[model samples]
Target: MSTTLTLSTFDAPARPLNIPLPIDPPEGGWTWPPTSVTLIAGENDAVLIDTLPTVEDAADLADWIEASGKRLTHIFITHGHIDHYLGTAPLKARFPDVKVVSTAATAGIIAEEQKTKRDTTTYSAIFADDLVEEVVIPEALPADGRFDLEGHDIIGVSAGQSDTSESSYAWVPELSAVVVGDIAYNDVHAALIETTTPETRKGWIATLEEIQGRNPQVVVASHRKADAVNDAGALAKTIEYVELGDKLLSTDPRPTLAEFVARMVEANPTRANVTTAIYSGAVQGLR
Candidate 1:
């Protein structure tokens, strides 16, 4: 069964707009629904913001793209996270000629992670046991800059780090759209565990501000439904989430990171994963 969610575009000075791609995790051991893949249509070609988490999801997206009748010339990967990139192989297989764009750092990280995951017995057992022997590695990452797609341009920006060291961002000037990956999330709390320092959060905020400064018509986040945050509300929420993490880190001299996360979760029940990540990072720091 499939589900759909509609996100309305906001009217602001920048003219931000977005249509949310419905994604839910799969059942029985698989992360359900699926990550939303935003489609940014330019004058000539279309750019796929991010790939879903599985082959099935990628196939679904390909079907949608085919139905739209628009040429998908580029696939932009926001980061190296498995949830954001695992579906890439299928997409590449389907569109053998489309360029897969990302940062050099991100490409290296993805290649390393894919290699490690395929070789490690523990990782394979837990995540890919069903297809441990059928693992597929990705092709080379596109070099940074504007890649020609048919007659249009797809730009990959090395926007700097966020939750992960290799995080990257993409921009399409013609479409007035920016695919921010996990740099900016709406409604859901920010993931802090993957981030090493408050500096990383600051960098993320700075990047978002820069994107907004560009006044794009649409901004596509890696997770959550995509919508235009023309005003300050969505941005404010993002800042608030980061501030909350900082605040939690300030108080409580707890030694055990898990305990600290539990406390934070107690205070903010809605931010379970965010709290857990913060706790994990704190624990790692102590060690």
Candidate 2:
């Protein structure tokens, strides 16, 4: 018999960056929006989705999970972004036998991040003091993309592009929930750094639509505002943001990066991390 499941979240606070950016910093400095780790617990076992970005964060998350008194059976990474999987080593240290898996593509990307020293080089340029020193690339998930937790199924669906090229989300039918990594942002600026072009945005919109069609009762954004609600409505808001970004990029006599960011912020006045998300994307020189 399938055990009844409960879903919970550990929302990590925004990390202030050490690097300087072209735009004015917020309060202290530029900050990555807060990210979350979802826990799906059954009677005695649970599965974790997306490790946070740093060792200290993961250590705290480990303590939180330990308090739940459930055996962590697996750690499923939603994407290959350094922030998403960097905490794996600490979590693995805490739960030595927990399996860590991701899609082959994401695994390859994480492997590349390790091989290229992106953590110590590119990422280090900004979060030098906050990043985990060790790299932990997850093993590839089974081809079927299914994991069993107390007889319930958690499936991984491959997503073409979002904040990153190779991404995926976890689908848990038993709970009517979808752990959509960076595919959907809640009350935060959508990361446009990678998917600045119209075509890539279209693919992202399609993925969000697919998640919408599922009509999940619970939707978790990997990067979410602390106060934002976790519901399928986030999918529509994310699509709207992507569409607005596309329009802004295509404006005739295209707006200056400053102008572009101003229009986006005006449109999304309440969204957090305009500097990191909107500014960073525009700074990429998107046309």
Candidate 3:
């Protein structure tokens, strides 16, 4: 018999991690980490998809998990972005028995996440003294193996490269849900920093296409609109975001970063976290 599968979502409020720009002194602050994490509850155990960004954020999520009354069996990290899994250490301490796992490529990203955090001006400027000091490095998920839980198989979809390198999605068959990390964003500005070229951006869209091929009813993304958290149409919104980005980037006259930002902001007037993110993408020829 198929076990009854239940999924719950947790959203952390957005905060500032300042980033400097060439023209605009500072366009944004305190509106980014509307990060959404998932808890998949099964008959005897639970699985978590992605962690929050800061120690405080993780602690809050940890408390919620403990109160949920489900044993955290495996913490599934969707990708390697520090924001996506930085809270792994704190969660591990709270749930000592939980096995923290990720794709081999993600594990490699974890190894370098700290250094990346420390090196970034925007990240280090805000969290210089208090970054995730002790990152809980995860073991590689089984090769070509299904992450079995309560009769459900949590498989990883290789998203060639997204906002970061070696990104992926956690595809759970029983629930028809895909825990998309940074590969697909919902109602928020898609981070296009990684899509600096035509090829990579195409790859990102292809990854989104892969998600559609699975025909998931529940689409969960790491970053999402707080009001519409876990919206089933999130996947389409993400696809739209990227397509819009492409159009802005390859327009006739070649609009500058400033032009792209203004247009994107006007179009997505209410989307949170547009500052350095859009600037970066625009300058890098993404937006």
lDDT of each: 0.55, 0.84, 0.75
Which regions of candidate 2 are displaced past 4 Å?
A: none
Q: Clash pairs of candidate 2?
A: none
lDDT-wise, the better of 1 and 3 is 3
Pairs that collide, model 3: none
Where does candidate 3 have its weakest 10-residue lDDT segment?
22-31
Q: How accurate is candidate 3 locally (lDDT)?
A: 0.75
- Give me the candidate number with maximum TM-score: 2
Ranking by TM-score: 2, 3, 1
Scored by lDDT, the top model is 2
lDDT: the better of candidates 1 and 2: 2
The digit string of per-residue lDDT tens for model 2 on 100-164 reads: 99998999988988888855567767763567768888889888799889989999888878867
What is the lDDT for 13 in model 3? Answer: 72
- In model 2, the Cα lDDT at residue 81 comes to 82
Tens digit of per-residue lDDT, candidate 3, span 8-92 = 8888877665444444434444345478899989876899999876767888899999999888999988887677777888888
* lDDT against true structure, model 2: 0.84
Off by over 4 Å in 3: 22-30, 114-122, 127-129, 229-232, 282-287
